[model samples]
Target: ETFVSRMNLESHPDQPEWLSHVNASVLKVKLAMAIIGISSIHLLKTFINAGNYDIKVLMWQTIIHVVFLMSALAIALTDRLLSATHAAAKAGH
Candidate 1:
């Protein structure tokens, strides 16, 4: 609530008319990421418990997981940046 109040008081410099508001799409994406991240952690633990650990396989899995997770995060951030640019343009900034 305090953050929202402060944001309302400080309009975008380039587009004074622009107001910060809750973005449902962004929230949904974040929620999905949290779910997937938690599930991945649980699966990793289960894999370890299975006691058939192969260093080669585990290393590959870890690498692939990190790559995909980073890519997803990059895409999400890029989407946000693009949306902000578009909004500024629309506001005649």
Candidate 2:
């Protein structure tokens, strides 16, 4: 709903005044979380069927999962910092 509303507002010329204040970073964070969730599920499935996969494949999957986790953490941290900075700027004003 949030994304749909944002998209709708973006497509129209006469958007509400508050539309400018909407933080799109939240959506990015949510997407990052979803990617992490999907990566976790894939890793879990691979683990569950360990016998079907080679050890090298399992290791690679684990490495990929870790990379996804790190990427999500980086995105979340960046979003937090941006939000804090934005808030501080507003406070200064």
lDDT of each: 0.68, 0.85
Q: Could you estimate the TM-score for every candidate?
A: 0.53, 0.72
Per-residue lDDT of model 1, residues 39-86, tens digit only: 589558857765676777677767766766776677688878889998
Q: What is the C-alpha RMSD of each candidate to the true structure, in Å?
A: 8.7, 6.3
Residue pairs with colliding backbones in model 2 are: none
Tens-place lDDT per residue, model 2, 1-93, is 554532566657788877676566777777888988998899999999999999999999999889888988898899889889989999999
Q: Where in model 2 is the C-alpha error above 4 Å?
A: 1-22
TM-score: model 2 vs. ground truth: 0.72
Best by lDDT: 2
Error of 1 at 56 (Å): 0.7
